[model samples]
Target: MAWLLVLQGCAGWQSALDPKGPAAGELAWLIWFFTGLCAVVWVLVMVALVAPLMMRSPARSEPLALDAGAEHRKVRLVVTAVGVTALILVGLTLLSFFANRTLAAIGSDAALTIRVTGHQWWWEVRYEAAQPSRILTTANEIHIPAGEPVRLVLTSTDVIHSFWVPSIAGKLDLIPGYVNVLDIKADKPGVYRGQCAEFCGAQHANMGTFIIAEPRPQFDGWLNDQLRAAAAPTSADAKAGADLFLKRACVMCHRIGGTVAGGTVAPDLTHIASRQTLAAGTLTMSRGNLAAWIADPQGIKPGSHMPVVDLDGDELNAIVAYLEGLK
Candidate 1:
C-alpha cells in the first residue's frame, strides 16, 4: 500500500515518468530498466546471505576443512560473478549511449526555433523567423505544434537558470553569455507545466511557464495573431488609463506594441491580459489581481523587479482597465 501511494504520486502532468515525447519516453525506459536490474541484483544478494544461515547446523562439532578443490571452486565462483557484474555495467553504459544518440537525432529537421531568454523569474520567449517582420515575442507561455519537434535556444540575461519541462524534455542550463539548445516535442495537444529547475533567486519557486501544444494550423493562426500590434483602446476609461501608463513610470520597464513603452528589463505587456497567469504564475489573470499587483507588487511577489506605483483609486482603476484591454 505504501508503494502504491508512492507510484501514484509519480503520476502528474509535470512528471518525467508520465512521458509525452520521444526524449522523455526513452528516458523513462532507461529508468525502469535500471530499477528492475537493481532489484534483481538485490534479491540475489539477499538469497546468498540467507542461504549460508539456512544450511548451517547449530550443533556441529567438527571444523570444516578448506580443501584445495573447495578453494578452487570458491575462486571460480567469485571470478564468474565479477565478470558478470562487469558485463552488466558495460551493457548498461552502451544502452545509455545509444539512448542519448536517439534523443540527439530528434528535431534535426525542426521547423521552428524559439530563443528563450531566462530572466530572474520570468521567461522571455521569441519565435525566430527568416523574415524579421514575422517574428513574434511573448512571455511565460510557449506554443508549439503537436507531433512536430521544436528547438529551443536558451540563454540567461541575469543569473543562471535551468529550463525544464519534465514531460517533454530534460533540464538544460541557461548560462550567461552561453547558448544551449534543447529539442522537445509533444505527442498530443495539451498544456504542460514547466519551471526553472535551478535555484536562481528568491522567486525561483514561482518561476513557472506553460507549454501549449496545438495542431499545426491552430498554432500558425495563433502565431499570426500574436504578430499583430496591440489592440487600440476603445473606451474612455481605457484611454485615460493608457495616458496614465505612459505618463507614469510604468513605461520605463514594460513594452506595449505600437506604443512608446519599449523597456526590455521586464516581460512585455503587449498581450499581458491574454496570458493565463501574472508575475510568473504568482496570480491568475484578472482585473482585481492586476489592480492589486500594480498597486502593491512587493506585497504580491517580494523581491520582484517590479516596484510599487503610486496611484489613487481612480488612476489605478483606469490603468487596470487599460491593461485589461491590451489583449
Candidate 2:
C-alpha cells in the first residue's frame, strides 16, 4: 500500500500519469478509471466474503428443509448480480474501444515525419525533409516542436525492439524489415526520456533516447544546425586527433561529414559532442568519457559492437579531442 502511494505520486518525465500529450493523457485517464473500477469490485468481493465469516454460527443438530421462497429469492439475486457484472464488463470493453479510436485519431495531420531505426544497442534517427539536402540525421536524441504533431516511422535492422516514451506515447514494436508508425506530440516545451521497451540484446536495457520539445523557432534552428556538416577542428591538438581518428580503425564503422570516414555501421559522429549523452545514454558526453569508451568499450557496455582500440595514451587523448570538437 505504501508502494502504491509512492507510485501514485510519480510525476517525472518517464511517468504515464504525468502525461504531457493528448494520447498519454487519454491513456492515463483510462488507466485510472479502470483501476478505480477494479478496486470497487475487489472491495465488494472482500466485503461479501468477510460478511459471511463474521456472521458464522454453529451448525444445527437437525437437518432443516429448504425454503422454496428463500431459494427463489437467492436465484433472483444471483441472476441480477451476474447481469450487472456482464453489463459492467461490456461497458468497459466499449470504453476501451473508444479510447483506442481516440488514440488513433491523433497525429493524422502531422507536419513532420522521422525515421527511427533500431539497432541492437542504439537508435538511428533521421528527420526527413522534402529536399534531400535538407534531411538531418542524428542518434540517441530527438528534437521536435511543441504543440505540433509528429510521426515516427520505426523499423529494426537486426532484431525486435520497442519504442516507448511513457510521458508522451505508448510502446510500439520495431520489427525487422517492418515499418511501424507512431505519432506523438508535446503540449509544452520539455525533455522526455524514452527507452527500448523490448529485450533485444545484452545492452537492450541501456538503449535510451530523449525527446526535446521546444518552441517552433527553436526547433527550426536546431534542425538547421543539425543539417550542417561537422565543424572543422581549429586547434592543433584537435587537428592531430582528427588525423589519428582517420588513421585508426574508427573510420571503418563511424562517419564524419566532410571527411573520408564514411562507415555506416555505427552512430554518426558528425555532431556527436552536441548531444547530451553518448553510447546510447550509457555515459554523459565528455572528453574523459569518450577517451574511456575508445580505450575499452567492452568495459563500458559488454557485448557492444564497438571494439576496444589498442592505442597509446597520446593517441587516445588526441582522438577524444578530435571527436569532442565535432560540435
Candidate 3:
C-alpha cells in the first residue's frame, strides 16, 4: 500500500502543481478547479441516482393516473438540472476566456525576447537583442532572469514540436513557417525541466530542454560568458583534435566562434562544453559521452539528423578533447 502511494505524486520539478511562475500558477489553479468541480458534480450525480433507487417503492402492476405533485417535482428537478448544467458551461467558458487573457497579459510587456527554433531532435535557443553583437545563441539550455517575464518566439524548422515546461507555463506548438509567442516568468531561481510534447520522430521522447532561472547579475554574467568565443585548445591532443575537426566534415554542420568552422545547419559549438547536456538532452556533457556522440550518433539516438562522422580512435579522442576545451 505504501509503495502504491507514490501514485499520489511528489510534486516534482516537472509537475504542474509545483508551479514556479505566474503562468504555471494560473494553469495549476485551472486544473485543480476543473478537477474539483467535476468530482463534486460526479458525486452529486451518483447520490441523485442512488437516492431515487433507494426511495423508489415496489412497482405497481396496474398503473394509475400520475400524481400532479410528483409530476411537478419531476419537472422542477429536470429544470434545475438543466439550469445548473447551463451555469456550469457558461462559467467554464468565461473562466477559459479570462485565463487566456491573463496568460496573454503576462507576455504583453515582455522585457526579454528569446527566439526558440525547433529542429529534428534539438532546440536552437537565441537571445534576441537590438545590437547584432549582443545576439547570443545556444542550444537545449535556456537562461532567463527571475521575476521578469520572457517572451519566447517559437517556430520549427522541420516538423511540428510542442514546447512544454509544466512548472513554468503550458505547452505551445512550434509549427513550421508559423510563429507562436509564449510568455514565462519565474518567481525564484530554479532549474525547470522541459520536453518536446509533440511527436516528431524516433527520438522525440528524448528531446528535452532546461530553463535555468537566476538572479539578474548572475544571468548577465552568464550571458557575457556565453557571448565569448570558444576557448583556444592549449594541450597537444586538443590542438591536434582542433585541426582534425576543421579538416574533417564536422566543420560543415557545426559552428565554432573565432574559428573557420562556421555552419548554420547545426547547433553552435562556441560554448558546447559549457552546456549541461549533449544532443538536445539525450546525454549529459562528459568526455565519454562527447566521444561516443561524435563517433556514432545513430547508435545513441536512432533517426538523429546528425550523421556518423568517420574518425579513428586517436582522432576521436583528440576531437573530444578539443570540444571539451571549448568552454
- On lDDT, the leading prediction is 3
Residue-level lDDT of model 3, residues 179-277, one tens digit each, is 999999988887788889999999898788888899999999999999998899999999999999899987899999999999888999999998877
lDDT pick, better of 1 and 2: 1
Over 4 Å off in model 2, which ranges? 1-11, 56-64
Candidate 3, which ten residues in sequence have the lowest lDDT sum? 2-11
Task: Give the alpha-carbon lDDT of every model.
Answer: 0.87, 0.87, 0.89
Candidate 3 lDDT at 20 equals: 91
The digit string of per-residue lDDT tens for model 1 on 111-227 reads 999999999889999999999999888999898999999999999999999999888888999999999999998898887778899999998987887788899999998888888
The CA root-mean-square deviation of candidate 1, after full C-alpha superposition on the true structure, stands at 4.3
> Global CA lDDT of candidate 3, please?
0.89
Lowest lDDT 10-mer window, candidate 2? 1-10
Candidate 1, number of clashes: 0
Steric clash pairs (candidate 3): none
TM-score, one value per model? 0.93, 0.93, 0.94
**What is the TM-score of candidate 3?**
0.94
